[model samples]
Target: MSARLRPTSLPWSVYEHLAMVVGLVSLAVICLAWLPLALALRPVLRGDIGQRLGRLAIMRGFQLYLQVLRGLCACRFDIEAIDALRDQGPMVIAANHPSLLDAVLITSRLPNAVCVMKAEVMENPLFGAGARMAGYVRNDPPLHMVLECRSALRHGAQVLIFPESTRTPGYPANPVNPLSRTAAIIAARAGVPVQTLIVEFSSPYLGKGWPLHRAPRLPLHCRVRLGRRFDPPRDPRAFTTELEAHLRAELAGPKTS
Candidate 1:
């Protein structure tokens, strides 16, 4: 059976597009504004302090953007065990990429985290500068990513990685993506565990291949449920298999929006 497609009302479509434009303009204003401050402090700020300033700025921007989304629609978020994950150190928080906002959501909340991002995001006008200043690791070679994550973990920072590598061809409403072993390899080397995060949404508004103009059900609801941490085994293959199995089971168990 084909998925029922609802016609988007013209008024709602206009509102969404307008809201997104306004929000993006505001974000650009914020990032551009901070660029000056960063340059001004270039002489006085060095290393960690400079990076902290950048992290703080980006974190605030992410939170502010989420608030904008909330104001535009009836959007709600349900997060569990996030606070618990914050306190833990040197752990890999394996996340499922269902929407474009997953990294923003995770990094914004876990401001101390080191995220593995694609090379393209590093060049993104809206996110690149902040990411570079925050000392985020680029998703280049898997080995390089692993080393960077390990170092961050040693420094008591949580590392966030999307095992799928990119947005899956089908998101949560479809079959799950294959789990990458980079995270497992890093965890095994660093002696940390991989914590799974399941992101469920009431609508696939920002899901894979979804256009920004596609308005989802009003008051879009998103939930994050934390799953058990897996200890990496001596055999990397075994660890990867276990990680995939665990995630498949948890993500398949229920739907939460």
Candidate 2:
């Protein structure tokens, strides 16, 4: 029989701490460096040009951050599966959010993908400027969020959303949170397929309620695998049920390295 997977250990060695610092500083540098450019171009480059530039910048920045992690932080990521969706045309890219890095992992691969971010994060100075310029949808005032998602889909951009709406609660015990119907509703209204992606982490380092100041185990491993894609739903409520069940099943099945 296969052995049950255990949580990764948190080590507070000097190497581990230094790795964490490197990861955090590299990310901050990348985001801050792009902030000025993003802010400056926000008004001048409106519409598709702005979106393309913003999303591309975010993607490349994230890619560079991941490279830093891999090089100096002993992090391993298997996220190539996401690249397949880059040219899949307009679609709702739904995923099970396990950690804070889920969006960064997926978006780093798809330059044309726009995220569905929290209303507050969409206003934060650190990330808001670039996100706004990327034409990312803000998850507030439900009606407006759906309308914006549909518009982005119509523009042939993949809409990246976490159906759980936030990081999954109760980690190992609850593989996923009950999915919000937003993803289903968006896909239904946009007439786009819901492409599911399953994100797994070696440990719950940056999961819900995890502290930013806390250091994690070295050699953190993260993997993203493509999941089932459901056709545009005629009944969003039913689709949410099915999507939630499917995600739970996939996450519960097995652990892969």
Candidate 3:
């Protein structure tokens, strides 16, 4: 019985490793393929046309990548709730960052979404050019980030922000990190609502301390559900506190996958 089980388990293990490699390679190929086009469009097309095209391209690229993961990597994503926001007009999309792919999953569903990314990520060689073209705001020099996000909202682009500012640490033990006031401030200043998104993952793959090369449990699942939407705040500080409590309640209640 042990000898028979070994062969069966070995093949399953091999498949898991292969799937993980495929997922990573697919992401790299997509980014590399878009690099040159993003570079060319950055200087040549100035203003809305360039930014819109860049964002649309990114949305498509991410959509394709997710599809690849679904088909080839045996991953599952329940993100249809995100599509409802695509045509909802200018709004601040605030989500809990559980994993690195939080942005990717959300951005893949919204064509006009502009992300608020770390300054370093916005400057990375692999993602920087495309992000610049998409007019993604950098999360640094707080005032600058606020101004950029406001401008994007004014132009009818959905501003995607992670209130935690980074992935949650110690996860299940600490449902979420302390919320930042940036999203609330931006929404208030821009006169846009804050649409909260709750992203749940079956595994901690690509999470705060997860190793990049580690093979995640096969058939990993991710689900994004709509959460409470707060109107443009009259007082951002108060709103931040409310938002933080709301997230904690939602994330701590149950696991959905």
Those runs of model 3 whose alpha carbons end farther than 4 Å from true positions after fitting are 1-8
Native-to-model Cα distance after best TM-score fit, residue 37 in candidate 3, in Å: 0.6
Identify the leading candidate in terms of lDDT.
3
Q: Which runs of model 2 end up more than 4 angstroms from their true locations?
A: 1-12
Candidate 3 TM-score versus the reference? 0.95
Candidate 1 clashing pairs?
74-219
Better of 1 and 3 by lDDT: 3
lDDT of each: 0.73, 0.89, 0.91
Q: For candidate 3, write residues 10-68 as lDDT tens digits.
A: 77678788998999999999999999999987999999899999999999999999999
Error of 1 at 256 (Å): 3.0
Name the best candidate (by TM-score): 3
Identify the runs in model 1 with alpha carbons over 4 angstroms from their true place.
1-10, 38-44
Residue pairs in candidate 3 whose N, alpha carbon or C atoms collide under 3 angstroms: none
TM-score of each: 0.86, 0.94, 0.95
What is candidate 1's lDDT per residue for 1-257, written digit by digit as tens?
11342226666556656666665566677778776665566456767676667777777777787777677644677664476777777788888888876776766677677788998888887667667777678889778877888887887778889887877666665636887788888888898888888777766666778886555655467877788788755677788888778777877866764
Q: Which sequence of candidate numbers ranks them by lDDT, best first? A: 3, 2, 1
